[model samples]
Target: MAIRGYHAHLYFDPHEVGHARAVAEAAQAAFGCPVGHFHTAPVGPHPRGSVQLSLRPEQFAQFAAWASEGREGLTVFAHGLSGDDLADHTQYVIWFGTSEPLDLSIFG
Candidate 1:
């Protein structure tokens, strides 16, 4: 390992709270790391909307189907996200694990 390490952050706009929250909960239970934060708010002047799974600057790639900044490994922690079917708000997924993540531009 190098003297320094890197991490990533991701924002997702799910359409369902239960779905999104499930993903977050699953991640927390699976990973030894903390879940960081989770919350909900309104969008476009409407009421009763929620966007879950907000990652800190430090849980993004664990659920990324693709890679961004790390070497390919058989130890991938993806392919296990749950309840992730919400709408268009913004939930940042911050990953601080040892695996490097793919760049954000790829998502664009």
Candidate 2:
């Protein structure tokens, strides 16, 4: 299935919230993608506090590269939005740092 878009979740702890906001703001400024709320608590299947960046398919490569170098010490969980939540979170995912275990049971 063709990916409709992408979601990159920047995971952070309370101590790193400011850094995460800076990273997210910088990405929004640079890439013109919409940045979601700075979630201090886990939302959906995310395992930690996270900020979500929504990107178009055309923006994926550049954003991914930029994020790789710009994420500081945060773990980035990126996945393609392909309709099927399970496949999107599993098969179509990419990680920019140490991967974290997502609560995939939320998808079921």
The number of the candidate with the highest lDDT is 2
User: Cα-based RMSD of the predictions, in order?
Assistant: 12.9, 0.7
The deviation in Å at residue 68 for candidate 2 is: 1.4
- The 0-to-1 C-alpha lDDT of every candidate, in the order given, reads 0.33, 0.93
Per-residue CA lDDT of model 2 for 1-108, tens digit only, reads 999999999999888899999999998998999998898988899999999999999999999889878888789999999999999999999999999889999977
**Where does candidate 2 stray beyond 4 Å?**
none
Q: Candidate 1, overall lDDT?
A: 0.33
**Poorest 10 consecutive residues by lDDT, candidate 1:** 1-10
lDDT of 1 by residue, 3-53 (tens): 121222222334454554554555456444344343344332223232223
> Residue 96 lDDT in model 2?
96
Residue clash pairs of candidate 2:
none
**Alpha-carbon TM-score of each model against the true structure:** 0.30, 0.97
